[model samples]
Target: MDDRPNPIDRNLLGIYLNDHLAGATLGVDRARTLADAESERDPALADAVRPIAEEIAEDRAELLKIMRRLEVPVRRYKIVAGRLAERAGRLKANGRLVSRSPLSPMLELELLRLGVEGKAAGWRTLRRLADADTRLDPGQLDNLLERAHRQLDTLEQLRLRQVSTTFQESGDRPVHQESHA
Candidate 1:
């Protein structure tokens, strides 16, 4: 009996992979930018994010490799749009006009977290295909999934820390008011 699964629709698979490639491009750019910007102000954060940024870049390469194995041609326009979108994200108001706002890191971290989560889902999707597709590596996808989980944890911790500092003065706590009749 044949063990190979039925072939997937190459056209649809190509489109899906290309869209993820665009997202990966934006994610790599944003991760590097966040790491560099945090270096001066938050060395610890820079240290934590730097590795994740490198990993994200590596993950992007891996995605490209997978696309090549699947014979999916990258859509250049999508890559360009991803680049432009990343730049445009910088224009959002962050409660500061000139200098970097404390809110900026918070927002960036949240975005990065969301991207990683999406990437994780992509990895899982490929892993599912790996069961019948010899070209897809389930073990590699598992490793990628684990790394994404770690990155999510780190980003969440950093984001929570930023929330405390950005929303409250050093020693201040939220005050409660009693209801009046």
Candidate 2:
């Protein structure tokens, strides 16, 4: 039996980079679409969501830049897969025929919250690697981490408002129900 040192797993890094890149792309698309829908629904909400959409785009660009700096190739197939997944998400049986359901916004806000959480974890991982990889900057990662936290705060506020609006009592109780009064 011959024992030899194992080759470096270069594909692992490429896969990791591609996965995050795809995720960022998906996040950007979802953010833009949701921003447009919400803004159209209530013009006043535009003020709250417009900047978030812009920031998401900027973050996606940053991820691409990072991939470039690391010489990691962005997999086109992954981007396509991400787009398809986003499209499939809309097909879920939400009990609505054509019009948007009240639950849609709540589900979307939850997705955004989860995406932000994932982004924060990615930033933290990159920050850990910054000490070893000169291409990565700790400062930039720190800024991104902070921004993700702020994004979560904003998303949480929006989610809470949506929850209140979507699931609140309609004050139409059944005839069998006794009035507290």
Evaluate all candidate structures by whole-model CA lDDT and list the values in order.
0.87, 0.77
Q: Which 10-residue window in model 2 sums to the lowest lDDT?
A: 170-179
Candidate 2 per-residue C-alpha lDDT over 1-181 given as tens digits, one digit per residue, 9 for 90 to 100 = 7454343345786798788877877777777767776665544444676787788778888888887888888899999998887778878888788966668777887887888888888888778767667788888889999999999999899888777677856464212233365
The residue pairs found clashing in candidate 1 are none
Cα lDDT over the full model 2? 0.77
Clashing pairs in 2: none
Residue 136 local lDDT, model 1: 89
lDDT of 1 by residue, 1-181 (tens): 9877877888988888888889999999999999888777777778888898999999999999999998889999999998999999988888778877767778899999999999999998889888767898888899999999999998999898878766776358433333465
Model 1 lDDT vs. the true structure?
Answer: 0.87
How far residue 33's Cα lies from its native spot in candidate 2, in Å, is: 1.3
Q: On a 0 to 100 scale, what is the lDDT of residue 72 in model 1?
A: 89
Worst 10 residues of 1 by lDDT: 170-179
- Residue 180 in candidate 2 has what lDDT? 62
Q: Once superposed on the true structure, which residue ranges of model 1 sit more than 4 Å away at CA? A: 1-4, 170-181
